[model samples]
Target: MDFVKKLPRTSSGHDTIWVIVDRLTKSAYFMPMREDYKMDMLAILYLNEIVARHGVPISIISDRDSRFTSRFLAVNARGPELVQETTEKISQIKDGLKAARDRQKSDADKRRKPLEFSVVIFSAALHGWYYMVFVTTVGEEYDKVFNHFGYVKCTT
Candidate 1:
């Protein structure tokens, strides 16, 4: 659906790459190209590479570069009936996407619950997130407490 141009020229003279993607299936194609190719040549390339395999697309989303816009019009003008079918297909895809989004939201709603809890302060002193008591008042602090819990000794 877009070109990555101005690449280091290959031995075959390709300096651009056309990156095409199918949104629904998430499949992609990277076709090498010459940067100087005209609109008509690009159109022919598209017909051969894309249309030959996947048929006409439901719609194309592009950045509206002049080359792409011209080619888009040329491709779209193939027939009125085809255009109408493409339009309907586009609408159907949009509706399907909306339905998928709604389903996901419904699933998430089923899992949603309010947080309910309480904090119990067992220690008289709150040192950072952990609660502990510093031992300025302890009679045998090292033997009675801290030493048994090694690293916890520093915390107190």
Candidate 2:
């Protein structure tokens, strides 16, 4: 599980795409840009805004856009192939995520039947058995912790 960020052009200007992912949990946020921003400004934005909130990630991956690689390039000479390769890599990541999510849901559904099994196995115990089964079978809702837009709303 790695974190990846992408800069996509939005209606406002160039927006930063922030992706935070764990094994089965994933969240994406689109952050709009301020005026006259540079690559250094972006680094600061990533460090202060994104990393500060999520803590340091294991790895950070991004496309070879000018905003990411201009400091390494010589004047106007930048690699177009790098951009193409990075774009393809991102697409593959998106597809993999979709598959992982679907599989997780399927497995959860399959495991849910153990609640019914507990009834037969623990027929002598009435009160505590069903309570334990109910708590164990229910997964935490991601929506309660994060919104569709990836903002962390404090429920407490």
Candidate 3:
């Protein structure tokens, strides 16, 4: 996302073009606004016009533009809730989390397996059973089968 500033004013009082693009898909939104618009206005506009429609992005890359500086965000966009951090401190935290985060994702991918039966797992917990076996048929021929598992046969 970037801004194209100092253009001829439109009849609608819009002179700046807010160029926001999705890097993965190459889709774009060329929003029109005034060059003197405040950061608070811009942030709200971004949330409504961009995030509301597309969803929150994982990250955003910018060109270190003056308008996007942390000072502007800290003062205007995020007041008391957000604590300003030094660049070095931010990088240190990022480096610390990177390895653990990657390992967790890798472990999750390797060990993941789909459930065979959804209802049986839930039902087992509800009934306090260690195991459940569905018996569909019963006869004299199946007597040995029932006896091995210790399941009582029902006539009805």
Candidate 4:
């Protein structure tokens, strides 16, 4: 989560945008906020904008802005267990993202393979036609030259 400050004020004088992103889904929510809102107001906004919709997140990653550093926002938890749980969640998210990327790349490769093959075949045919034109124009011994190079007998 982060804040984008110093934006142009709206008609109601809101000048900050709360930028909340769900890391697992890469989804984002932008909420307009006033610059001078206190801890309580911020809490209410958080509850309404985020918690009310997504329930609760497993953990939050933030820039630790002054609003977040306030005592009211702090949560007490067992240190080792919190660390382990956070680590496991992060590892799973990473693995899922990697697998998604790999699948996307495989699909892209499948789509491109036929196009690449077509280009190769088209260029070969063009080259063969060009060679035939050159041989015919240069001399009457086209068959001898073609047979000597063994190009006419070549198969796909």
RMSD per prediction, one decimal? Answer: 14.0, 20.7, 18.9, 15.2
Residue 21 miss distance in model 1 (angstroms): 1.3
- Each model's C-alpha lDDT? 0.75, 0.55, 0.70, 0.70
Off by over 4 Å in 4: 57-156
Clashes of each: 2, 0, 0, 0
Question: CA lDDT of 90 in candidate 3?
Answer: 82
The local lDDT score (0 to 100) that residue 105 gets in candidate 3 is: 97
Better of 2 and 3 by TM-score: 3
lDDT of 3 by residue, 37-131 (tens): 89999999998998898797555556775556656666756533344545567888998899889999999989976444311211222444344
Model 2 regions lying over 4 Å from their true place: 1-71, 74-79, 113-156
Kindly list the per-residue Cα lDDT of model 1 for residues 87-136, writing each as its tens digit. 99999999999999999999999997744343222322334444444434
Native-to-model Cα distance after best TM-score fit, residue 26 in candidate 3, in Å: 1.8
What global local distance difference test value does model 2 have? Answer: 0.55
Which parts of model 1 have CA positions greater than 4 angstroms off?
A: 57-156
Clashing pairs in 3: none
**lDDT head-to-head 1 vs 4, winner:** 1
Decoy 1 TM-score against native: 0.36
lDDT of 4 by residue, 10-72 (tens): 998999998889876789999999889998999999899888987884555566744564454
RMSD of 2: 20.7
Q: Alpha-carbon error at 40 in model 4, in Å?
A: 1.5
- List runs of model 3 lying over 4 Å from the truth: 57-156
